[model samples]
Target: HNRAGKGLGVQLFHSIEALKTYVEGPTFEEPVDGITLIQEYILSPESYITRCEFVGGNFVYAVKVDTSEGFELCPADVCQIGDLF
Candidate 1:
């Protein structure tokens, strides 16, 4: 799911019995390749984009994905493609 600013990834398992039954025995590493719940924290897309910037000419452009529609400095149609970095 797209959690926006929340840097979390979640996976749900049915039950503990199902997990144990699939694994048979608990070990550091499973031999038979059992289904085990796993979770990892990842950086949010907004955060990822904020860390990256595009530098061209004399301007430093940051990823402003949530900027207001009325905040445009130049018109899309009139702006030259090559001038947009």
Candidate 2:
């Protein structure tokens, strides 16, 4: 789900029970074939995330992602995602 963008497989759980239910339920699915990673969510004052692209330790480019639209950040038309962000 790398290019799917907008935190496609990301989920936030406030409690252990909720997380368990999700993991046990059928709704919990991942397109990727690998381990499911659990991590803490950092609260952001702004409704966006910045991604800096680099190649071989050299800077390539950077973009400010607008998360107000629920994390679907791929701007490419091939993704058929949404409005440009």
Candidate 3:
């Protein structure tokens, strides 16, 4: 919101249904400038999901829900988990 130079009056919705109501109602007029809404799924840390990205000057990785193989092995243990499922 800060990145876009729009009016200060902005409404927030807690659910998709609420957002749909706002957009479909006759009282609402679509902003001429347009609006962008971003929705992200929330997941637990033990889901075995990996979020790998380039950050800083190197590649950074993170796991959601479960500890990854790279996490279980570090330093000397790195080779032990090489064949881990």
The CA lDDT of each predicted structure is 0.38, 0.71, 0.49
Tens digit per residue, CA lDDT, model 3, 1-85: 2233221334546798987887789867655567654445454556354545566869886534242432231222343444564
Tell me the tens digit of each residue's lDDT in model 1 across 10-81.
Answer: 233377675566456553343233533344434354422232344565446554343222212232344434
- CA-RMSD of model 3: 15.2
Model 2 / residue 61 / CA error / Å:
1.1
What local lDDT score does residue 36 receive in model 2, on the 0 to 100 scale? 74
lDDT of 3 at 61: 63
TM-score to true structure, per model: 0.19, 0.69, 0.33
1 or 3, which is superior by lDDT? 3
- Tens digit per residue, CA lDDT, model 2, 5-72: 44566777999999999989999776565557777878799988888878899999888877776656
| Decreasing TM-score order of the candidates | 2, 3, 1
Best by lDDT: 2
Global local distance difference test of model 1: 0.38
By TM-score, the best candidate is: 2
For model 2 the local lDDT of residue 44 reads: 90
Evaluation by lDDT, superior candidate among 2 and 3: 2
